[model samples]
Target: MAETKTPTPMFPVVQGGGSLIVAWQIKGKKVVVVGGGEVAAGRILNVLNADALVTVVCPALGLNPEVAYRVAQGQVTHVPRNFEPSDLDGADMVLVAVDDPAASSIIWNLCKERHIPANIADVPPECDFYFGSVHRDGPLQIMVSTNGKGPRLASTIRKFIAKQLPKDAGRAIESIGRLRIKLRQMAPDVEDGPKRMKWMIDVSDAYSWDDIGGLTDDDMDNLLKYYLSGDVPSLNVLKGLPDGKDASDIDLFDGSFGFSVGA
Candidate 1:
């Protein structure tokens, strides 16, 4: 008999804190934020934008203008008192942003006992999750984190990455979705899931509209036509227009979109 040896794993396993990143759905969920300073205000805004029902547990005097405005509008519930362990009740997630480490630790332990996810600002060991610099483009979002370390650096890197993306990235994404639907309708015979996925991947990697100056309505029509009846549109169809217009002038590729990212 020949000796058999187990093969090593392809990727090294990392063991440490804050190594996993995930997008959590907090919509319509109850989130408790325990602080009233600027950091807490930022977290509150993020939760509010996610449509989470938020409760802020802090003294009435310390709230920043943005948080106070939301409270006045009834967008968020204001506890108007210092955080207590009881504040964590009914919370799906908790963010401890208070300045007092003792109070934050108490809240973190309580949340752990109750099995609720908790994040304690500036304290990695006490946090169940860490807030990251986030960039949003319609349905697409990118989050960058430094494992509970150096948030400023993470934010700087995020801004640089954001600048490299096309301004109409979201619209481009929608156009790609429409193309996927058309491709599927045209290739109904490809039934296997893996085969269909591979076909989509190949088409996406091989297809390019750069030679045509970018994606345009005419280009989309031509693409559909090619897929359906093998007719290719003229490459010069969108070449000449008054005042230097080109395919990039098309709304689908126009660089006129903007997105907000939060730290």
Candidate 2:
């Protein structure tokens, strides 16, 4: 018989070594952005969407058109001077976008001393978090990150994923969220947690995106009533629609879920 040997392991066995991704909530918090160039403009927009109070520390000459417009509109405060150590005061988060490496390093170190999270553009090692390419649709946001490598590639990947989703996916999510709230309010006191979860899963699995999107408030009430009675309602019972349907009826063929490369 020929000698047999075990193959070598192809990957590392370490666990919990990569970045811990999270949807951070920074509403009504202070975010200090250093520099007012194009890079800083992108950061400011992201923080603003999260409802963070932002202050940009940079010379007036450095402000890009977008950043200057924000300052003029009173959307964010512009100090119009070089960064100061006091800029970090009362900051919930910090982001550095200046072209000066030495100045960025100094700011990063200051954030470290204060235990504040920071992101230094183009300097992955100094960054506490890396920004990901994001796709936003109402309350839904999908992000793709390359762990500080090949940012453009990550963006390409995000677009690819978006192309596979249905155009009404976000609308479906909103409708389901409303139904979930109504279900919680109407659940009988005797329904246990597991029972409630099982019925929810069953209902979600039984419906398509278009079906869910087409549901009315009265339909939701009828569906929950059936579930509470130990019945997973069919499409016919809930909306008087055909019960046997598949994903082909969705809007996937329209190309990229209402998103385009230019978008």
Best-matching candidate per TM-score? 2
- lDDT tens string, model 2, 115-213? 999999999999999999998877789989888998999999999998998888888888889887887777755546677788778877889988888
Top lDDT prediction, candidate number: 2
* Per-prediction TM-score to the true structure, in the order listed: 0.68, 0.81
Candidate 1, residues 117-217, lDDT tens digits: the string is 98999999887778889988865678999988899999999999999886766666666676666667667675545555654455456544344225565
Candidate 2 whole-model C-alpha lDDT, 0 to 1: 0.85
Give the clashing residue pairs of candidate 1, or none. Answer: none
Q: What is the lDDT of residue 186 in candidate 2?
A: 76
- What ranges in model 2 sit over 4 Å off? 1-17, 188-191, 240-263
Per-residue lDDT value at 119 in model 1: 91
TM value for model 1:
0.68
In model 1, the worst 10-residue window by lDDT is 254-263
